[model samples]
Target chain A: MINCKALTKKYGNFVAVNELTFQVQAGEVLGFLGPNGAGKTTTMRILAGFLSPTAGKASVCGFDVETQSTEAKRKIGYLPEGAPSYPEMTSRSFLEFIADSRKISISNRQRRLEEVHELLQLGTVLDQKIDTLSKGFRRRVGLAQAILHDPEVLILDEPTDGLDPNQKHEVRRLINRMSERKIIIISTHLLEEVDAVCNRAIIISDGKILADDSPKNLESKSKFHNAVSVKLLNSMNLNIVDSAINSLPEVASTRIDENNNSLIAFPTKGKTPLEAITKLGAAEGWDFSELHVESGRLDEVFRSITGGTAR
Target chain B: MNGVSAVMRRELRSYFSTPLAYVFIVIFLVLSGWFTFNFGNFYNGGQASLAPFFNYHPWLYLFLVPALSMRLWAEERKTGTIELLLTLPLEMWESVTGKFLASWLFTSMALFLTFPIWITVNYLGDPDNGVILAAYMGSLLMAGGFLAVGSFISATTNNQVIAFILTVVVCFVFLLAGFQPMLSPLVGWVPQTIIDSIASLSFLTHFSSISKGVIDLRDIVYFALLISTFLYANVLVLNMKRGE
Candidate 1:
């Protein structure tokens, strides 16, 4: 549904987005992950047809963003960064104005307005001016305006940036519900959000795509791969336990947690830590209370890719 | 609706929704009335027509129109609303025309409120009502011209104060182009035809002619063309400033 080739954007000597290229298929929720100033917003703006690329070309729904911007814009519903809206306009009037500008037929305008109002939970604030609302409500109003026309693609920049946890969950659910029939590209730093809602995630840093893959795949590629925790019942000899675990061929490294005396183990390649643990328990008769194993989280994966902590 | 008309309606609605439009209108009406009756000494002169009232329009629009237009695109950019506006399906020209018409129409509302002066003149003497009508049209056209220039300047920056100041400076030049003290010596140095043409480009020259109850097609076309030219420039500026 969206295609960009060697897209670059610069403001004088400052490069906002550099020779970046990516695409989104129809009905895919592609989460854009990046630290601040990673050119996420600039890339989204270029794709939305708001800013022309400095050197390359972008197209949406088969329409060129620069030459055929109108058609390209028609196919995309854009919720810009910071969720900007006219402060003086009531939510209903604002939506009506956007609908009219988008050339929605008058006959269906009322229904479409109601549809988005209900979808974004903005019915109560329909008559209230946008400036009077809280940030979360205002963001919802921005969302309603973007999706009011039901465009084929939705480009949301930090859709849940300022929302509280509950509001974030609500927005996540809303985005999840709209996943079918729309090419949704969400640009955000909330890594868990991508894990919760996006099928595929793209990690960007310094105006370049670092890694793009499924959330699970990203986690699997993390450095702390297949690590596990084994807590003891506190009756075992530390030296004997350490030697027995270290003697295993699969055990690459082991460290006992000072506070809990739990053993943290890292297994080498082509080895199953669980199999090693079971065999070690049989051989050494070690008592343990907990044995848990899991892969790294999306946050760890994101931090590894972007080379900075995700805010 | 067309994109221009849609933008125009949004701008008009913005004026009404905020205090900006009302404040501008009230100030415009009071200043217009004060300039005509008090400042111009209406009763002392006992003028038969609205010459005293229409004479001060250029000076009034010099400041008033800039205030109305200062926030046009500048405020949008400052607040990041330009992203929302430009990403829409509407073409840039449509947004430009719509915003210009909105400001122009709101200005016309403020200009129209000075009608009581036209009535006051007719009440005092047998003023040429045709001249009053022509003067009203001239004032509207002149306001349109000022608004177009102001809109163009407003599109250049996100600071409304800067927009207002830049527009005032530009409009000052246009208003003074025909000043005899400024241009008379130039007439000797340059061709007389070129000097006259420069003088003719001054809004004061064209607007004063129309206010005299002579609706010259050239003057009418001049105002219309000036408005279109600036509006076109405004669109191009918006496209360039936002283009990557």
Candidate 2:
């Protein structure tokens, strides 16, 4: 387990991370979400034992991060922001260097190397210089080093920030593959990633966490939750669709999406208006192209929850 | 031990990976030859000793050692590898000393390649090879001192150029501290003991003292102290900066 208690960090006068407290249990993949300069990196650095907290404390696997950093760091696999590695070194030598630094014994070294190589798919780029490899390979190389020792706690900062869609999916798969045993915390602004991999998401804006819960629970807080959405064949019928949907007694409000030729009807408290909307559409003989009830709009909740705040 | 050797091995490999290593070695050899024969007049003296060669090493190291040490920590910061390194399960001193040792060994190699000169002098006339060996030891210790100082300055900034310049400036002071011209102005205002202490701290003073065919323990201790003090300072700077 990773425990952080009231962790705070200050850069002279400004507080980069303010009175933050959270714990991560084994088998948990926690996603840290925040705007740029919202203290996500700072908080991760503190947990990785790179920076000391001005107040409170953090520990990894029962070892204190500040006082017993060496012991704590031994069990941590931290991929710092930007996935920094020596550009001059080939990927193979660089991983060997990490293995040597961590003092992985000779008998166990080959197995460890092979494990990470398979986990990160680093075979083709092993001999290539890190400088010439693409961003995706460099990121995987960083991940390879982080997991080289088979550490228990994995802290990755923006692990997929610069990758393409396919590469991002591959990295997510790798994370999920390793999520069964390790305590993984990844910080990113990508909300869908939280929905895809994270069992829990923590959203912070201006150096403080505003919400922490399962992604589904956070999404359920959106105004679009359980809201009925309908797409008509023509945008000219938006007014008719909006008025018809709002007339349903279960609908608390309605919105028109002119761009997509769709209208969304928000359900009243403790009600799902999808069934009522379908009945109403059938009675009026409205030609609907698409209709579904949204669980939530993460983007809308993200904006409303983190929007209009000072950085 | 594992951490130090791993860091040192990687550092050494990085040096060789770039053409900088070969360029530095060639320039060092060529400059040492030019200074010894042209300025010190090795043939004209005809003493059969490598006195001319030994005499110019302090000046030679002033420029070259800083070039080698400038990349020690500065490059790590610039490339953002310092984060990867420090987060590993290694203590601060291990990385610092490991980098220092790698640069020192590289300098030692460049110095060792000058053995043809030593052999040439012996073939020309009968010289005290023991004194020559002692001079080689002194030269290496002085290079180690210069490298230690340069490494400490390297940790202070991310810009290699800035590190190079500041190391040159500080080492220039160490070289000139014992000179009469530099000290004459302070001779009156500064107290006698303070002046003596400053003079004792000069690299030129202890370095030249060992060149007189005597490997004094005090001189060795001076270089050792110089190396350790600056290396410890390097550790302190790293602990404070945390590579920014």
Candidate 3:
């Protein structure tokens, strides 16, 4: 579990993290989303006990990050941005050193190392210097170190940033698999990553929390939610189909996508255009090739929430 | 304590894993040998004591110790491993002490390898082995003091080059603080007590006293205090870094 209250971090005249607060419970994969300079990494660092907040307090698993840093840190597995590691040391030794630092019992240390190495597929590069590994492999090594101790809370900053699609998918799956027992907080700019792995998402911008909810809830805020689009067959006229769909009580408006020869209908509040459209189609003998309704678009919601700024 | 040993072990391993450790030891031995035989005129002195060898340590460590200490914290910061290290469940003092001990142990190893010089001196003539042993202890303590200062400065910057230069400049001041040429100019302008206090802080002064084989409590305390002071500063700097 992670709790942050009015956590603010400032560097001289600039405030990196404003008076922001949020809580994450165990077994929750919370996606931390923000544009660049939005205090996402700063927040993660504070929570990881790497940086102390200039104001307010943050705790991981109920231990205060500042006053009780060592205890707080004991419960956290942190992957800093860029996945920085000692370049000269082999990956295996590096993880072992981390295991030792984490105070893993000597009996369990070797077992934990083997388990993480196998999980991250680091066998091939175990004895190789970390500097020689590819970026994806290096990122995996960082991931392995974070999960080595299997701490109660995992604070990963951009965990899947440098990984390939497959590696990213594997990492997401790993996070998902581990999500049932630990408090996982992943800070990422990737919208699709949230959709793929996160059960809840928090969107922050300019050091402030703009939105916090489930990924589905955030998507439902998009304009496309509950909207319907139908592709007309060559036999049907676009105007007739559009006007007929638009005339329905549930239909708010209709627009024709001329390039695709499709009719898109917008529904009014608490309305379903699917049943009305099906009835109209059956009665008028309107030929349609495809029909579907959109749950929502995450990118649209993210762009709107983050003010369309590139992170 | 476990955190400290973990960091110490990793640091020691890192030193040996790369070519840096070998290169450092080789350079240290060669330079000390050259200084003792050539500059200090070990063969010409006709004395059986290791005076010529220990005399050059203050100057030798000025450059060599900084080279060793510069990478202690600067490399971690440059490589961004500082984040990984600090975020672990280790205290700031634990890591600082751990890293300092590793560098000190490596320096001690290099100092130990110069045992052949001691053996040669004993082989050629009957040297005062007691005095020689005391001088070795004094030299290592002085090296620890220099390393502590260098390590503290290294933690303040990310660039090893900058750390080395700053350490050299600071250590040079400490080395020259008691020297006549440096003190002569300040004698007329400053008070005699102030000059005496400044000279008392010099590494050369305490090291010279210890090298004489007396091993006074004051000299030992001087090096201890200097080392603890610098290491305390190292811990404070890291704490400040965490705040930043």
Candidate 4:
């Protein structure tokens, strides 16, 4: 539903987004990950038609963002970073205004407003001015405005930044619920949010895309992919277990976690360490307390791809 | 068109929802009344004309109109609502025209509230109601001219105070351009035609002609062109902000 080609945006000598290109399809939620000043928001703003790119092109639902901005914008529901709204207006009034601007029919406007109000749980504070609402409520109000018209594309910049854990979870769930019908692109620094809500993830750093793949695929790039760790019920001869586990053809290497008295084993290519560990436990009478397979760590991969440097 | 109306509705509501609309109207009424009675000598003028009342509009709007126009875009920029506004499926001209109309309509409301002055003149003696109507129209149009300039200046900055100050200074220059003192300095250094053009650009010159019940096509066209030129610049400035 969205395509960007060699999209470059510069502020004088500073390149905010440089030759960044990506595509998103319907029924896909793409998580945009990057550090501060990594061009995530800049790219999203370009896609939302709020900022013009210095070079290259971007389109939403086949409408060029720069040339056909009105058509492109009509398909988009954008929640800008910080989710700013008119402070003096009530949430209902603000949403109504947004609904009107979106060209919602007068007959359907009230129903649409009520729907978003209910969806975002904005009923209690619907009549209160936005400036008087709490941070979470204000963010919800922003979300309500973005989704009020039910546009096909949703570009949310840090949709869950200031929310509490429960609010974050609710927002993630909302995104998940809407993922099947819309092309949702969310830019956030929270790795866990990508895991929970995104079907695809792109990590950007210093105005360039560092990695783009499914969260699982990106996590699998970590060194810990397919690694297994086993904990013994009693602190017995850890070397014997380590040696026995290391002798298997599937085992690539073994390391002892002395603090936990556990043996962590790395598997050979295309190998399953669980089979070897289970067999060894059965044959050697190795009493196992905890045994599990790692899905690989996303944070490690994120840090490595982003260079683990403070922007 | 829907976008324009949506923006206009919201902007008009914003003025009323806060203390801005009421406070502005009260101050405008008081000042116009005070100026007409004290400096204008409306009661003492035996002719029973609204000349004193209409005469103060240009000077009154010089300070008051900026206060209304300063917040048109500066507040949106400062509060970051400009992002939300610009991202919507609305055109730049729609938003600019919408905001300008809202402020102009609000100013018209304030102008309308001075009806008692019109009533007072008619009650005290026979007055030219045609001239009074013409003056109201002229005052509203002059407000538009001042507001368009102020709104354009507002779009160039994010600070409301700076927007207010700059708008006042610009409007002041435009108002003073036709005055003899200001024109005298330019007469010797500049060509006669240039000096004539500068004086022709003055709000006072055009407004005075209309308020005197002389609604020339040129004066009306001047105010219309002034408003259109500044509003066009407002849209351009907003577009430049998006580029930045």
In angstroms and one decimal each, the interface RMSD of every candidate reads 1.1, 2.2, 1.3, 1.2
Encode model 3's per-residue lDDT on A2-95: one tens digit a residue: 8899999999989999998999999899999988889999999999988889999898888999999999999999999999999999998999
Model 1 alpha-carbon miss at residue B244, Å: 4.5
Candidate 4 similarity to native, TM-score: 0.95
**What is every candidate's C-alpha DockQ against the true complex, given to 2 decimals?**
0.81, 0.66, 0.78, 0.75
TM-score of each: 0.95, 0.97, 0.95, 0.95
Give the per-residue Cα lDDT of candidate 1 at B78: 96
lDDT of 3 at A268: 84
Model 4 C-alpha lDDT per residue in residues B104-180, reported as the tens digit of each score: 99999999999999998999999999999999999999999999999999999999999999999999989989999
lDDT (Cα, 0-100) at A164 in candidate 1: 95
DockQ of 2: 0.66
Residue-by-residue lDDT tens digits, candidate 4, A28-112: 9999998899999999898888889999999999999989999999999999999999999999899988988989988888898
Q: Over the full model, what C-alpha lDDT does candidate 4 score relative to the true structure?
A: 0.92
Q: Which ten residues in a row have the lowest lDDT in candidate 2 chain A?
A: A302-311
Ranking by TM-score: 2, 3, 1, 4
Pairs that collide, model 4: none
**Where in model 3 is the C-alpha error above 4 Å?**
A233-249, A253-259, A282-287, A309-311
User: For candidate 4, what is the total of clashing residue pairs?
Assistant: 0
Q: What's model 4's lDDT at A71?
A: 93
